[model samples]
Target chain A: MRELLRVSAPVDLGAIDPRSTPGLPEATAGEHRKGWAREQVALLGAGLGRRQEMLYATAKAAQERPGPADRPAGRVLLVLQAMDCGGKDGTIKRVAGAMNPLGLHIRSFGPPTPEELRHDFLWRVRRALPPPGYVGIFNRSHYEDVLVARVASLVPEAVWRARYDEINDFERELTDAGVTLVKVLLHISYAEQGARLLERLDDPRKHWKYNPSDIDARARWDDYQAAYAEALSRCATDAAPWFVVPADRKWYRDWAVAHLLKETFDTLALGYPAANFDLGRERERLRAGEAGAGGTGEMNGR
Target chain B: MRELLRVSAPVDLGAIDPRSTPGLPEATAGEHRKGWAREQVALLGAGLGRRQEMLYATAKAAQERPGPADRPAGRVLLVLQAMDCGGKDGTIKRVAGAMNPLGLHIRSFGPPTPEELRHDFLWRVRRALPPPGYVGIFNRSHYEDVLVARVASLVPEAVWRARYDEINDFERELTDAGVTLVKVLLHISYAEQGARLLERLDDPRKHWKYNPSDIDARARWDDYQAAYAEALSRCATDAAPWFVVPADRKWYRDWAVAHLLKETFDTLALGYPAANFDLGRERERLRAGEAGAGGTGEMNGR
Candidate 1:
């Protein structure tokens, strides 16, 4: 799954089909593919919960290492980017939601507010990173600096173009700070987006979601695709690589993301922090309340 | 449900039991109460999706309301507060998660960062309110000013005490700005909290969640209860109402919050905006590519 999904080099928008369902039984029909993906997600869900807890435990251990630490405790940030109707929210619910919310932090970046725009693109993002022992999910992230800014001309050609290396450097610094960064781009075809946009228009319950300007944006579909391909190629790195998850099928997208996260957590080889104090004594003290606090600490020299 | 849960009058914390399950079927066994709460939530989940659409639609209509609007478009902000081990995250996943993520914004406030502490307590919170069309969920909110600061004496006695009416006035200003403010206090008993804190210590998977300082805070339980009582008495208001949700039972807590959110959204009488353009012509234009664009201007004078 990692090799299938990971964009190891710059992306060529024309070569990779959005309809590709990597790592799946290709011969299966659409229904069976979805069913198989859902089944895999169910299995992944259980493993993910355990792995996430371990990752959390790894961070806790680092914090309590009882000395100045050279390395940061483990924390993961999953940065997600997608087109207007791409399934960022669904992926969050289906994949990340399976983890314990106690250790999850989700931040969705919207069009910049007046204050956010006054600062550099990465400023607000810097504030949203998950603390140690947590998984931070970015619904859309700093990639917007290059992707949307380039496609929509939100910034000048020179300005948005300059952000690629800046992004790479920023991500390197994050990894150096003890953050694991997994960037995913939910890849969907122009047809798929148009179909989803039409659904929003057709369904009254969905009308609020449709921005007529999206149609204007859709008119510039090739431009955005070109922008995404450029960003994917320029910014993906060893420390914070990008994956183009096939998102035409929602379940496939969810499965691919879950797989990526599980792989990432597995690489961390997370484990619980060992008890630093006498467990039996603490248990006894807790059961007996304050009167027993000093009674059980003789051997530990408390 | 509103009368039962809403703090229409100044709250008497002692009078409201943390175990109380208001508006629920009476005389149910523990298992049945849990099962029943789950059942109602499943039903409310469907209603909630529709109501939230109406809310989003209401915002769209206001933006296109054919006049200079005196008020901002409508939105909802739910500010949540609770003690350690309270189920704020669980409530978010159960209630707000059911809404369309397109229109939901959630911000979890941790201990103030140094920059945040330099500002007044409400400064950061004011920045997190949902934009005109969204439902903003604060996992912990400014009530921390009155609750934790008061209990822990992090600030001077006079400082935290004066924040009560300041908070009320702040909320009133928000309502006047067209945001429906729903403040919830997830009220749980000290015994329940102790049990939860112990579970954090006993379970390796939960160890990271247990803070030693929380034990010191737990030692000041009565003090927090007093603080919560005073804040509730002072801050509950008609423009921005407070609901003391009984949170000893996770299922009941989830159900009550979902219920409150559904009621709030329904009261807005939300509806989709009238098609600002000729829908028939717009569909034709979308289907024919750009050839039919200018023809969509008959009835709505677009």
Candidate 2:
């Protein structure tokens, strides 16, 4: 599944069918497909939880040990990118929902503040990276500098054009520092997006998520698609490849992302850290109920 | 159930049985009790998730409106304090596990770093408060100044003694500023602590969580209990009340915390924010597929 979705060659966004489920078993009924995908997501989520615990445990052990600060313990960063109403938020709610919040760090990037805009584009991205033992997710990320900036003319052509190598170098540096990157682009068709926007408008419950500006962005769909194609082709690298998931079907999109994460964790082969102290002595102390053995009289006067 | 667990009057730690299932249905078989409690926790968790979404939606709506910066929208902070092996981590995993990670912010405070120690005890706590519309959780919280510091003499008695009022004043400020606080103490018996510690030593999988210092802390269980009783009594307030959930039974503890959170959210009576835009116009535009309506020609030159 990872290989099927991964971008090794140039990306042509128009060629990929947003409604197709490529690797999953075909179903005659929509309900069957949705149910199967949901079950798969849940099963994969449980595995991801166990693996994340191991990753967190390993990092904790490394912190306690006397060693170089740059010791390579596994950390993961899942980067999600999509257009307005592209299910980025929904994907996070479902995929990250399965993992323990203790081992997850999620950051959503909106329009930059004045302070963030003053720094280099990568400055905020660097700050939001996961520490050595957790999975950090970017709901939208540095890729926006190239995508939105390019399509909206927020930066000059030359400036946005130069970010591809800059992004590749940045991702390579992260991979070298023990951060596994899973970059996903939720691929939803223009017609599907219109339907989703209409649904949001019709349902008062979803009003908080609807924005007037979304229609403005939708009007330039072809321009954004071209920008995405360029970004996907140029930024996809060996160390940090891109996976474009057909995201019109919500269940299939979620299952695909969870599957990608599970595959990444499996490659790390993480496990519980061994006990560093004397196991036999600790067992004896616990059995003896040694109330006075380590008494330091710290609380005695009180 | 909320009234049963809430700390309103002077707390007597000795009067509460750690093994008691106060308001839940009693079952002759342990498995039956566990199953029932699990189902209730799930049901309560689902309700909590919906209410949280409404809280988040309300905050988002408020942000878009022109209003005072301090305009009230619901925010929640769940502070959990427990002795070693009292199920603080497990409770968070089961209870917070049921909510969308998008609406949750969890921070676990370990021993203070030198920089943290330099600041007033509440400095870090202030920084960790949930922003408007989110539910923030503290695995261990500011009450530690009165619990661990008081019991271990980490600070002079005069200093730790003064923190009770300081904490109350700070909590009052949070509530006044529109943050709701749910303070919980996972109450486990001394014998249960010993059993849990022994289990950690017995299972290699649990070894990473074990620390030799835990036994040292266990040695002074009674002193710690006295300290907890004092903290609970002094810090309990109407705005930010304390709930002592008997935590020896993991299932009941999770359910109780979920129930408490559900009740707190219910009190807020949160509903989705109404559409602030021209809903009818937006619906017409979406239905019309008005591709050129908002075209700015930003992407045309490229």
Candidate 3:
């Protein structure tokens, strides 16, 4: 993980001020650190399991409360980029797998629809944002405008360069609206990505998930990384920071994302609103034919 | 709602022993009874909003936690009859929309996929059953084999007649293995359904959601209802009872379903699991490292 980060954000690593974390020790490199990271991850996985069950229970409880503002409206958005078969699908399936349906939504951004192309680049993405009290997961988000478009030169350099500021401002607005934007760029080594792409070609059911154009994109890895670094440095804000996840290790990536999302939601302090109801009174009115007595003769079509 | 139920589940209503529910005092006419039912429905909606939010939250939390005995590990099966605007798409979006990405899945039962055409009728539906801890929302599930297939004479009488028992046994096995099966017969009146069909024709974006064949199907509403009534009567069990929801009003339908799902999850008894490492021990370890190791990692890939 540190190696990937070093390559992706070398400057930021040197410049950022230091702070302290409880569970994690200093970022180190060695066999011992690897072993320790594995053990901690296993323990974290167990906590994740328990946490998931509780989430389901809590969602069930929250349903009994009233609508709109009665529940916490905050959401988490996960953004990723990868070569074909770089574990993007697997990560989303596993990490976001157990979330409650009522509170979580996943949108896989494909080529823009006709409506999206007519407007500015960010319009379609904004439409996909989760409402308050929900979590929105974007498979490949607005970053595509920069990463894919830049690597392929689909848009001219000037057009793509201007997008860095537009993208950053878009993210800043979302964060200010209470969306905890945690961007993860899945950094799969080119070798691992190639092997997976070959695996996709070999499988019939998965063949549809692959596109030949992705191979052309993979050829320009170094160039894309430079584009990525430029965008991350400019866009990483206090509210939304980019995490370059090492996708060569699937287990590690899943663990890190689940851990990160759990931390974010924990900070929100979401729960059911205070309960207050008098069912008996409502029942009495029903028996006496008091409620709905004089409103309307019957339910109109409206 | 009761009138819709009276139509959807003719025998279920008649079998409801009057001794169970306290009947309202004598009214001037059945008009008053209709008024009373409307009021009861209003109250039910109020209670359902909070319940929906909590269910969503619980599912989100569950996504982070490790698998539990009760978490969905079994396959999900969907069954539905063929009808245009029969609440299939809306139901699919609403239910699947709220679930975690990991355990929540959906399979729309379109005309059989090429692979399905080679097998028996039930083969396709059986394959789509959700794995455990996963929620599967079937848009027009297997019931179509017995309902529309019977009503439209799409298959031989013998073929369709035998399917009812086959479906019942299939559901029994799924429930035995911890699969929570939900069956909803969205009962829309002929008048109400006509308005919906007309609206679909009027809306351009919704054009893709409409099918011209629906007009011919609507012409046979009574035949479809009779098929539904018979199939539900034989198949509805204690473990999985058909929810005869009034579909004329979309809000009420959403409310009823959200309520039903809440009741199901609440029955699961999902709660916080026992902690592995002592909280105090973990906290101590965290606080111990707070001074030496806590720092923001490098902001990497775009």
For each candidate in turn, the TM-score is 0.83, 0.94, 0.47
Off by over 4 Å in 3: A1-72, A276-302, B1-302
Tens digits of per-residue lDDT for model 2, B155-229: 999999999999999999999989999999999987778779999988888988999999888877888988998
Candidate 1 lDDT tens digits, B1-302: 66688885556776777777887777765667788888788689777766766777777667766477766788889888888888887787677655555567778887898999999999999988888888888989999988888877799998998898899899989999999988899988766776787787798767766666676776676677778778887887878878989898899899999988888877887777665655566565556643333333221111
Model 2 TM: 0.94
DockQ order, best first, reads 2, 1, 3
- Residue B16 in candidate 2, Cα distance off native in Å: 0.6
Per-structure clash totals for the candidates: 1, 0, 63
Q: Write the per-residue lDDT of candidate 1 for residues A1-302, one digit (tens) a residue.
A: 77778886658766666777788777765667788888888789778877767777777666666477766787899999988888887788677655555567788887898999999999999998988878889999998888778887899999998998899999999999889998999887666776787787687666656677777776776788888888999987888888888787898899889999889888887777665555565555456543433343331111
Identify the leading candidate in terms of lDDT: 2
Question: Which is the leading candidate under DockQ?
Answer: 2
Worst 10-residue lDDT window for candidate 2 chain B reads B293-302
In Å, residue B91's CA in model 2 sits off its true spot by 1.1
- Model 1 is docked with a DockQ of 0.16
Q: List the residue pairs that clash in candidate 1.
A: A10-A233
Q: Least lDDT summed over 10 consecutive residues: which range in candidate 3 chain A?
A: A13-22
Cα miss at B58, model 1 (Å)? 4.1
Instruction: Give the per-residue lDDT of model 3 (tens digit) for B207-247.
Output: 33345456566666567767877888877776666766656
Model 1 scores a TM of 0.83
